[model samples]
Target chain A: MFDTVNLEDARRVIAAAEKKAAAIGQPMNIAVADAGGNLVAHVRMDGAWLGSIDISIKKAYTSRAFDIATKDLATHSQSGNQFFGIHASNNGKIMIFAGGIPLKRDGRVVGAIGVSGGSGEQDHAVAEAGAAAL
Target chain B: MFDTVNLEDARRVIAAAEKKAAAIGQPMNIAVADAGGNLVAHVRMDGAWLGSIDISIKKAYTSRAFDIATKDLATHSQSGNQFFGIHASNNGKIMIFAGGIPLKRDGRVVGAIGVSGGSGEQDHAVAEAGAAAL
Candidate 1:
């Protein structure tokens, strides 16, 4: 059976991420996905960048689909790296960036959280806050 | 300037749609979009079909893009119809079927909601519930 994040869990994670975003003064679009790489919940904070909405959701899917932090994926997907063309796959859903992280349960990846609408460091920080809540 | 649904409005709409989906005994994937056809929020219930995820988001985009229910658009998009090939437009984002409804404010289209993971009728019903909330 596949373990995954539920709606309630997604809400809690989002709440934490929102708090972190507020602290950093960067509005963000946050998204959560289940183990199946299906979106569970998403939120675009007031004043968040509209374009980041799609990126945030797709980042969540990419993290869950690959069960890896997108920051690491970005490193491996650079020009001379093994995953150079991976982003062209997945119908453009693969987001090799710093804002996607897997959510773990009992040391197994159960889902993922993605944050956007800020610099890479800020987005990654917000996602980490959300993932820690899970 | 485009008057559009905000993040708070999207959540209220999603909550109402979820309630209706639960009443109808069907899990659903729901998505809400702004007047600009950008996503504001999306949710997939615990047992919602995974494949419907993309459909739900695209349906919302289609409704907002055309400012019409996909149900009505479907009729006009039938074989040999004027809009028969419209679905092939928008880089394949158009969904000529039920479950999408435009959200109006002061007699103006502002945004839209889309639902999936059930029969077309059920999906339309849920989307109607969401639109009513807006």
Candidate 2:
């Protein structure tokens, strides 16, 4: 009843994210969730920060929930914006920072990828790589 | 990152659940999450109940969150019990019912498995099969 990322694509996304993290010399926690915000894939690098594990998963959930990259959401979540309190609304699972990107299939979002354990720019870059794997 | 359930193990858990589900002639939605309550893997078998997708994931999260099986938690969630109304907490993600089981290694909880789209007893049995794959 719903368009979702298949298992094969989910693993491909994770592999791309892992490659980017290694290229950047930063370990990362990566997560992928279907359009329904259901987890499809996950990975924690050998040296990634443990705390970033949940953040990565939550970022993917938030991206799939909103159909937008978290960096864009970060702008709208700033003070006095339409979604100002959005992060605090979803049981503190909304990730307004960078590192979350929705995956598109024929111009429609089918899933999202999230990466953490680095600067916002680095995280976003890795997430972008994951999305590019589509 | 800390030692967590790898992606391979997460897939193995799902396959085990699928095998049990098939043997029983019932489809299922299975979920696996690491000890931190972060999602690791999820699969919704053909003809499975859509509603059970979220339930499966939440059951896994609840199991990992408390390090106890949902079957055991159900007892504590009974009326007048210590954890009554526990389902209303954590954004209503708690599944104080059967089908959730924690995955252990060296006697420490490392992750959890959950199965839905079946009776509580059936779900519990499927979840146990998934956990045994570890």
True contacts kept of each: 0.88, 0.24
- For residues A20-134, write the lDDT of model 2, one tens digit per residue: 9999999898888887787665677766887897899899999999999999999999999988989887788899999999999989999999899999999999999999998
Which residue pairs in candidate 2 have backbone atoms (N, alpha carbon, C) closer than 3 angstroms, thus clashing?
A48-B1
Predicted structure 1: clash tally: 0
DockQ of 2: 0.25
Candidate 2, residues B8-95: lDDT per residue as tens digits? 7888888888899999999888888886777666767766776887799899999999999999999999999999999999988899
Residue A46, candidate 2: C-alpha displacement in angstroms: 4.7
Cα lDDT tens digits for candidate 1, A1-134: 87888988999999999999999999999999988887899989989998898899989999988999898899999999999999999888999988999999999999999999999999999999999998
For model 1, what is the alpha-carbon lDDT of residue A20? 99
lDDT value, candidate 1, whole model: 0.93
Per-residue error for B18 in candidate 1, Å, reads 0.6
- Consecutive 10-residue window with the lowest summed lDDT within model 1 chain A: A1-10
Q: Which residue pairs does candidate 1 place in steric collision?
A: none
DockQ of 1: 0.79
Positional deviation of A103 in candidate 2, in angstroms?
A: 1.4
Query: Can you tell me which runs of candidate 1 are displaced by over 4 Å?
Result: none
Q: For candidate 2, report its TM-score.
A: 0.74
How accurate locally, in lDDT, is each candidate?
0.93, 0.88
